[model samples]
Target: MSAPRRPVLAGNWKMNHGPSDTARFFADFLNRLAPADDRSVVFFPPAISFAAAREALQGRPDVRLGVQNVHWEASGAFTGELSVAMAKDAGAELVLVGHSERRHVFGETSDETAKKVRAVLDGGLVPVLCVGETLDERNAGRAEAVVAEQLAPVLSIIRPDEVAELVVAYEPVWAIGTGVTATPGDAASMHHAVRERLAQAFGREAADAVPVLYGGSVKPDNAAELMSQPGVDGVLVGGASLDPGGFAAICGAAG
Candidate 1:
């Protein structure tokens, strides 16, 4: 209805694609890209490929780099953890907080995600806070409740202005890689609920401006329709993103 929010097509490599593979992916992707300024594109490479992503994407204003995750502290005694400052230093302009894998596999809580979100914002890096419901939750008709639960702590901590600085991704666990996608109506409903929640916690302005992305089995065939729905801003692509051609097609449709 509002011309759909500016399209943001992001790829989450997720534990796949090393630096060399990452470079190769970008090499092929860059060549296939049709220049367009209407859409926002981001590459969420694995932590190990940050440097390679930066190198490949440098001087390419149309594409930006985002890291899959970042530790809340600037520096710490923590091992195997990357700090927010380190993400910035690695040429990442954005960071994903509370991704589904991070929440389900690593047992990360919403409170922890809130801490990372705050740190990312404070460190001047945009945070794409991932929120979603699981298969069981959806079957139980608790999808909306689950989303609010996952997002509440984070929303409770940030101000209206701060909310404007963040992007909320609605990635249902059931649809992530099972090749199942929520119908357009389903995705739109969740995004609308997200907006209502935002309006309650922050304000109308923040709710309107904050992009609510849908992630999960998003492909070229369905991208345009999903993106066209009200309150559905963009997509966070998973498996389809592994192939440069497939990903490019999705971006093209999004654009």
Candidate 2:
């Protein structure tokens, strides 16, 4: 059977641009896109630039806009945080949660990530949840277990049917921005393992429907081989995504 067909090419801008830069990136990238006939392309800009990116994508049916992050609460005194409602209002159809930087640098735990995931769905937006293992964990032979732990909390809250609306990104901590990438076979292996874990946690149908993306040092050069993997439905591009031509190249490869 052909691999499940939910391929999403998402740009995780991380902490890259301001509102002006966001607008430029969108204009340049969206304008150059030939027409997304085979895959869905989503751009996750910094929270502050969501409105700008939205405006940039105005009337552009081929491109979609998403947010880099969202808070679990609808509204509260959480200073310096963007809430789910705010993200929706800013025109985000999807929100990224549990990225490695957030987990490692910002001290966000899986429980918090789960809350954010629930919030995104409740707010009528899809959550591109990220889950992966560190090099130490992989070296210690706990890769699957670590990923399972990261997924357990979210699974406890969301139903199996809800999996179709969600996208998962597996980005090994050590590989991200380190000029290191998981070999195509290794990436395929982990992706398969992730799908199996999802099948066990939810059900076979949900697992098969859910799209698992491989992220971490993804560039245009290796995009095709990575996308050819059995369970790698898409990519969560980072550094390469900051450049319009580079990101567009990767998306074109997905086709």
Candidate 3:
């Protein structure tokens, strides 16, 4: 059998943390974090702070740095947007695609996500594809369908072996930044559905190799339980991750 997939604890700093703050955050975080080979820990800082994060993570190659977003094109007339090559130049090893805020707040579409996924892959960067439903969709019992729709296009563009370079993060819009978290069972159920969808697209073996993460209001206190659920390979942290100590504790829970 192939080796078990490693748990990934990813922190999405979002719009917070400037370069100096990024440096300070990692200084404290790395101090608190004990080196372990059992899991992976990644930080998705803002594009501007990539340098500081990379410098802070100099000796620790196991802790990776990622870009919050990347444009599909290698170069463009588009201003204020960084392309995949630019992101790679900025030292990002992973790119977040289709985050809920990118969709709801900025109107990013699934097709756009698919393109970005392809670009990141071609650029030799991993894509942490975020998929989930809003509160209303979940209430209507259309959560799984919505997630499927989000994944279908991207799945079509990726080969089965490429699944190894992909990570799926389920971040319910209602739960994100609302202080409301889905119960472990709820997250696991959605993760299972996501894995099933991947199985259909890439076969069961490839699907099982993908690391499906549960996000949205995940905290140090509940992180262990969330990661314990079946199909929950890890977590995508937001506000709770802004705190160095708290994020370290959350990473510890991934074990």
Candidate 4:
């Protein structure tokens, strides 16, 4: 028999929630759901609320806390930047790098993202690396090339054995928050391609073991179909995750 796939459901609470709001959400969320022992569930909040999230999740073995972004430095005078050490101090077990918004809005280059990945891993935090293609690139038949390019620099920094410690989310730029989800077939195709690239870069065993999640408009209703795909390991939920019950349902589907 095949081993059961480990499911990861991460909530990217991008730019939402203050300290008080963070506390309230966790209070309600923890109270409502059973502990997620069979799967891994993460909450990725903005840099400002990392402490609040840490405080709330302390001693709670059920959930893992994550950070939306982290600078590729141990410590520095870089103004308004949160370093990997700072994120670790705040209790983040995972750090998100190369998110679509970070790439499109903040202009984070792949080289910088690679540095951040190394920083996070060196600091003992897992990195959730985001890679995908823009609508323009997809229309121009460059979707695969675009994603491959994004993965190239990061692959150079980490070994195949290290890939399992990192999570990759394939979120199409056009689908994020636009309420348009990629068909399961489309998502599976890209996920398979990503696995192929990993195999070429790191070899077969490492490629098959790495978990690649599908993000962009993922909700309870569509989660099962996406999960049914061979290469899809889990989901990176956005708006649906704001509600504890809704997110719980998505996790249950993964289960």
TM-scores across all candidates? Answer: 0.96, 0.95, 0.98, 0.95
State the C-alpha lDDT per candidate.
Answer: 0.89, 0.87, 0.92, 0.87
lDDT of 3: 0.92
- Give lDDT tens digits, candidate 2, residues 1-255: 123665789888888889999888877887667876578898888877777887887787667888887889889898989988888777778889999999999999999999999998888888988999999999999988898899889988997667778788999998999989999998999889888988888788878888889999999999989999898998999999999999988998884
Deviation in Å, model 3, residue 187 alpha carbon: 0.6
Candidate 2 segments exceeding 4 Å error: 1-4
lDDT of 1 at 10: 91
lDDT of 4 at 224: 90
Residue pairs in clash, model 4: none
Which stretches of model 1 miss by more than 4 angstroms?
1-4
Give residue 149's error in model 1 in angstroms.
Answer: 1.0
- C-alpha lDDT of residue 170 in model 3: 97
Model 1: per-residue Cα lDDT over 123-160, one tens digit each: 99999999999999999999999999988989988866
lDDT of 4 by residue, 88-117 (tens): 877778988999999999999999999999
Quick one: RMSD of model 2? 2.0
* Predicted model with the maximum lDDT: 3
Q: Least accurate stretch of 10 residues (summed lDDT) in model 3?
A: 1-10
Ranking by lDDT: 3, 1, 4, 2
RMSD of each: 2.0, 2.0, 1.3, 2.1
